[model samples]
Target: MQKGKVLSLEDRIPKIKEHRRRKANRRLIFLLTLFFLLIACVVYIQSPLSQINQIVVYGNDLVTTKDILSVSSLKKGENIWKINKEQAKKNLMAIPEVKKAEVRMEFPNNIVINIKEYSPIAQIVSEKEFLPVLENGTILNKSTLLADAPLLINFKTGTYLEELVAQLKEFPSEILNAVSEIHYDPKETDKYHIYLFMNDGFEISATIPTLAAKMIHYPSIASQLDSKVKGVINLEVGSFFKAYDEEEEKSEGEEER
Candidate 1:
């Protein structure tokens, strides 16, 4: 058999050296990449780029953006990553007018706060101005009259006012929207008597107990009435319409005499 040729030390030495050099080069490249990445992360964290730049507020009407931001405890220079969204929302919701609140970080350096404020359902007549009443029955003297909200005439701060708010909350939005004013006019037989003035030029006489349930069908009932006639809707008993015509009432008065 032919003897195997032995590789010269000079030749094998170069091959081993080249393999080691390549391995070292690869290791060096990996280390440098890792080192640069670590430095970049440190720089990013220390830089203002990681901090909040702007606060964007939405869905607010009663509570202003500044008020929301104040309660959120979020500042422009603070780190966005450090903010607790849940806690921020909780703080915003603690406000009397805020119904719901959501806080979100719009990456890099922005905070998005979306808030839903409680709309005033009705107002209590004060000495000269009307005090806004929320659905939860908290009165706000600072709040002005909302054009669409009904005025609560002859209403005082009591359970009746709270009950009024609770009942108003259940009404369909359109039915409630149609109302312009409500007057508390209690009779001897029914202490819950109320006179509601509709924006459509009709007066509705109803009680607090059945206000929401009965008013739900108001639009349907209004469709059946003559649009030209101004009348008082009596929901105190079975729903009925008595025309406010002077001649008719006079005729009835004469008959009673």
Candidate 2:
């Protein structure tokens, strides 16, 4: 084996000093980088860049964006990091129309609020004012300007109304839109009996229990009838059409002439 190389203490001391200097330099550089990073973080946190410059709302209807922001209490100048997302969400959920709410912070300074609002399935006619009825069967106290939805007459907040709303929830959009008005025409035998006035000049008699199952066939039933003929379509028992008595009488008189 070749003899190992040996150095004098004076030579080894310089080499050790070089290694220590390099290590010290590396540690100094790391500390400086860390200090700069911390300072940058503090400056960023205190700057306007950390503030919410814009607040955007999505998936909101029936509840206006301004109203949603008011409820959330999230302001444009508020720091995005300081906002309590869960609290904002809870506040949004308190709105009667809001079914779900989500809050998130976007990069650089944007706050986005996403909310899902309950849709109005029908409007109740109360004292000449139309109140929107949500899908969950809660009738709003505030009157609405929208007149396209079906008008429900003489409906109280009860199981009957709840059941009716639930039944209407499952109705196809076309079929639901065809309905213009619904009257709670209860009978001694059937408390759920309802009278529906259709947009196509036809009336429908159905019970709440069988409304969804039977009304799905209304389009096909109405298609078979004469468009000019006015009548009532009874869906309570079986699907059938019956012309108005006046129309039948007029037809008979014309036949005699």
Pick the TM-score winner.
2
Error of 1 at 213 (Å): 1.5
Minimal lDDT window, size 10, model 2: 140-149
Give me the displacement of residue 122 in model 1, in angstroms.
2.6
**lDDT per residue as tens, model 2, 174-199:** 88989999999999999999999999
- Measured by lDDT, the strongest candidate is 2
Model 1 compared with the native: what TM-score? 0.81
- Count the clashes in each prediction: 0, 0
Candidate 2 TM-score to native: 0.85
lDDT over C-alpha atoms for residue 249 of model 2? 89
For each candidate in the order shown, give its overall lDDT on alpha carbons.
0.90, 0.92
Q: Runs in model 2 with CA error above 4 Å?
A: 1-21, 246-257
Worst ten-residue run, lDDT, model 1?
Answer: 140-149
Question: What is the alpha-carbon lDDT for the whole of candidate 2?
Answer: 0.92
